[model samples]
Target: MALEDVSLHIEPEDIYGIIGMSGAGKSTLIRCINLLEKPVAGEILIDGNCIFRKFGKFFENNNEPELMLQGAELRNLRRQIGMIFQSHNLLMQKTVSQNIAFPMEIAGAPKHEIDKRVSELLEVVNLADKVANYPSQLSGGQRQRVSIARAMANMPKILLCDEPTSALDSLTTNQILDLLWDLNQDYKVTIVMITHEIELVKRICNKVAVIDRTRVVDQGEIGQVLLNPSMEITKQLLSGSRGTRG
Candidate 1:
């Protein structure tokens, strides 16, 4: 999906929500922030540093993209931005501890440091007992918790979550949301969550953006957008979200 003129300004330590129905381009917008998907004409700036800029409409055109960071530099920058997906995406063959240590190993961190950080993250996610367990042995929620621990292995300043709890039950979803809230408050990691569940946004997010048909129809503080939705699409979404937890 092509996102048109989609712009968002997320403040530090904010649990920002990007809400929309299926096929609304919400995933694309979030992926663009990490440059997993690049835009053709606009520039992406992280902490006021230009990541990518292009003037042309078509990315396949002859024009050169202004890549401020490429190769090793871009990889280093990605270290500061961690991504979580709907699927656990854990290595089926690796134990929880090994999975959590994967990112640090790729970055060439010292063995002792990786072990120490993995232990700390396991404790943070309240999965110290599951450190030796494989993804198949854990339940749905536990696997998600392990994934969360792995995403935090690098201590990223920003965490991009794409439907992190969409696969969990209601109780488990709330538990995950609470864990995320705690992480934001304790570690000050900015969270940008992509969800179709409006109630989930109200439960955890302070600010939100509503995407409809590949555009941001409404955005602001959670209270403002819910109380005074200016667009019809926003109102429809709100109405549809009632009684739906996931």
Candidate 2:
């Protein structure tokens, strides 16, 4: 899942989409941003501060040269970057409220604070009435909503979603997309979404990158990339995405 010379510029609060066929490194790219999967080389900066930087085999945290974040430092940094997976990844045995409160609990927030935050997040995801339900008691879309609330529990500045709606039906997909869009608009959370559905990108993303063979072959403003594509893979993806939606 290593990438080469893959560079993309994503602006603040942008719903940036990364589109590629299966095995094209889209998911890996998303994971790399959050350091779930570390890059072999390159720098990842957040708010213009270099959090991760590598040169050849050496890894360094830019704030302190020749140092790498470990233990609580790494965990604290990851808190500001939330991740949503294709699988909802909810705890099947935990109630929706408990699941959403997990991150806050881990962060050592008081029980009252966790409860308050969980209630607010549930309302944001429109699942307030399902607070006591377990993952097993919810539908696919509902489960995804729980995951979204959990990801937002710590009020992350950035959200990395890996095909968050791919498992749902068309109508459900649209619902999830709308929820994500609202989150971006309301909270101004930067979002990086990986999807094969170009239509999804068209509906929400302001910028896009097309990856091919572990390399970014096309990227830019969504409209510009779609209307004036420069690569065959981008063209093919645009065509196939249209055919699927049509």
Clash-forming residue pairs, model 2: none
lDDT of 2 at 28: 89
The residue ranges of model 2 lying beyond 4 angstroms of the native Cα positions read: 57-67, 242-246
How many residue pairs collide in each prediction?
A: 0, 0
TM-score of each: 0.93, 0.93
- For candidate 1, give the lDDT: 0.89
lDDT of 1 at 106: 93
State the lDDT of candidate 1 residue by residue for 1-246, as single tens digits.
998877799998999999988888989999888888877677788888888887665545546556656788788878889888899899999999999999899989999999999999999999999888899999999999888888888999999999999899999999899989998998999999999988899899999999989899899999999899999877877887744434
Instruction: Tell me the tens digit of each residue's lDDT in model 2 across 32-133.
Output: 877788877777788887767766544343344533556787899888887899999999889999999998898899999999999999999999999998
Q: List candidate 1 segments past 4 Å from native.
A: 57-65, 242-246
